[model samples]
Target: MENKIKLLYMLQTLDLKLMDLEEEKGDLPGIVQNLNDQINELQAQIDELRKQINEHTSTREQSNLDAETLNQRVESLKKQLYEVRNNKEYDAITKEIAEAEENIMAKMQNAEEHDDKQKELSANVDELKQKYESLQSELQDNQKDLQEVSKVHEDEELQLKHERDKIARQLPQETLVSYDRIRSAKYGKAVVPITRGACGGCYKTVPPQLNLLLRKNDEILHCENCGRILIAEEIAAEVNKVA
Candidate 1:
């Protein structure tokens, strides 16, 4: 009975260590994925800004061409005004010249506005690219750190798991099943020692008769309140000494 109790304790300790190792590894994958997602999103924004800049540049060029065409039309109308045959023809040429001048002014204004928008879009793209590069560097560093940590813990976790399996194999089938069930239900504590004539798991006082039986270590005992396997304090001390 003493040996069985000690084996359970050892198994529990190994299982707890394995759980801790798993927890350490669990968050790394998600963190890496989130970083990659951020980098991708930033890159997309950069691309969109670049596209907008291209569109604005094309529109600006078209406006400039339109302004040039209207200016040429105004010059031709002025030449025609000098050759007009009468006041009616002179007034018609003047009216045409006025309309062309107005169009030229409107096109030049539109081109200037497009130029300003293009500059703004280009600046935005540059800023987004810089942010993307910084995020990429951060992601690489995180990946390297995660790799180092995994390499360090892999062997230790494997050895602990092997030790836990060996100890479990040495325990009785019924006892092993009960221990696993209770450990799962009780957050990884299946066996507990009596402390101050009370259940160590639940901190409830044990009856005098039950406490006396627990101290004997002749038979497997369980705490009635929490259903955890009970071991005598002396038995726990002896196990620790041997370890």
Candidate 2:
């Protein structure tokens, strides 16, 4: 192949490397987004648990107030019993006292039930809080890990970009432009090595005469099937050493 094509092959190699590094760096942002989503979900669950605990506490307190009001009503009925004169009046006061006492008992039972529910809800909230703390810690660690990976990737990407720039300086502008166009068209693979009389880019059979000329290294050979510039192994090995 011509020296320009050989250089183009080298340029293609650098393009592939840069493409790989850029792809890895691109994935980092999505990974960070997923981590943040998980953290948000955990936070939302924690908030919901807190709201439940608050509601249960409020219910318990309200039940206790209802029980206290019932207790006062029972005391007032007892006082009425002491002031009554007639037998009928006495019976009426006794019935009122009984009814008031029953109401107080019912209210006390309701209060206890509410208190028990509050205890259960509070325990659940504590457990949820512990889970949230553990998840938060994991999220933070993952975020730190993502940051470290991103920094490392950025450094590597910068190095690869510097290398590509240096190689571009050594290559002609037209050749580099062709290299970029083909690299993008071929999914970051603008060059392929010929092996066993076949185009490695598309596995198509190369004509015997052209194959010989390819071996002579007089001109660049592109695969008819895939349109990628081809490099013979021996020439590639020599050039690789120089590179």
Candidate 3:
């Protein structure tokens, strides 16, 4: 039981050290993450706008071609008017010319509408591209800053995490889960040594009987006030000495 208590304390120690190392990096990690998300969103928007522009351009081109074909047909019909032998034939040729001209006008209008849409989409895409570039530059700078901070603590952090993992593996799964839960609730302090006959974590006075039992270090214990795992002064001394 004493060994278990010591191992838990050791794990807590390593966890605290790792937390401090992470704190040294400041908010660079979060900033880098946010920048990446924004970049991706901007990229998606740019790609979609570009797609719309391409579609509009294709539609305009096809409409212009259709209008040209109808104009050629109208010219052919006009020439056929001269060869008409009767009023009926002359009327039929003129009627064909009128229908072709109407179709040509409709195709031209369709082409102009698509052209306007294409221009508007192109402008929106260009603006999004500029914003994407700016965000990319900012992300690079923040990443560089994060890299600098990480380089300084890389080895130390790795060692501490390795030690923590080793100690945690030696503890029972239930015990480790309890410790982690308490640590999260207590703001990263799961284990504390009894100090001055009081709970070190909450500064609450300890009952005399409970104090006597803590000195035995025979079983794991917790402070009644804060619910943090408690370590006797002697156990803490032993662990610290070994550390």
Candidate 4:
């Protein structure tokens, strides 16, 4: 019974260490993914801004062409005013010139607005490009760090798992199942020592008879409060000596 309890304690310790190592590695993948997500989002924003800038540039160019054509029409109408046959014809040519000039002015104003918008969009794109670059660099760094950590811990993690498996195989199947169930339900603490005449797991006072039985190490004893396997001080000392 004492040897079995010692094996159980050793197994629990190994399992806990393995769990900690796994937790350490688990965060790296999430960190890499989050960095990638941020990079993608920034790239999307940059693309949308670039699209807007291109549209504005095309509109500005079209406006410029329209204004040029209207200006040419106005010039032609002014020439026709000199060749008019009467006051009515001259007045009609003059009116046409004025309307063409007004249209040209509107088109020029629209072109200027588009130019301003294009500048604004260009600035925004530049800012986003910088941000994107920064995020990309950060992503690369995180990936590198993750690789380094994995490389560093790979052997140790494997050895720990190997040891845990070996220890687990030594225990009876039912005992192994019970240990796992209790560890899962109690946050990785299936076996605990009696500390200060109380259950180490739940800090509950142990009955005198139960304490006496635990010290005898004749059989397995469970804490009444937390259902964790309780080991006596002498048994724990023997286990530590073997460890």
Best by TM-score: 3
Question: Is candidate 2 or 3 superior in TM-score?
Answer: 3
Q: Per-residue lDDT for 1-243 in model 1, tens only?
A: 337777887777788888888788778877889999998888888888888898999999999999999888888888888798999999988988888888888999999999999998888888888888888988998899889888989899889888888888888999888988999999988888889988989999878898787665556678989999888788777766654
lDDT minimum window of 10 residues, candidate 4? 234-243
lDDT of 2 by residue, 6-98 (tens): 766666666676677657655656666776787678678768867876777777678778878878887887888888889999998788878
lDDT of 2: 0.75
**Model 4 — TM-score against the truth?**
0.59
Among all candidates shown, the one with the greatest lDDT:
3
Evaluation by TM-score, superior candidate among 1 and 2: 1
What TM-score, over all chains together, does every model reach?
A: 0.56, 0.54, 0.82, 0.59
Q: Locate the minimum summed-lDDT window of 10 residues in model 2.
A: 1-10
Write down the TM-score for model 2.
0.54
Candidate 2 deviant stretches above 4 angstroms: 1-19, 22-35, 155-243
- Cα RMSD for predicted model 1: 7.8
Q: Please give the CA lDDT of all the candidate structures.
A: 0.85, 0.75, 0.88, 0.85
Q: How accurate is candidate 3 locally (lDDT)?
A: 0.88
- lDDT per residue for candidate 3 within 58-172, as digits (tens), equals 9999999999999999988888888889999999888888898999999999999999999988888888888998999999999999999999999999898888887877889
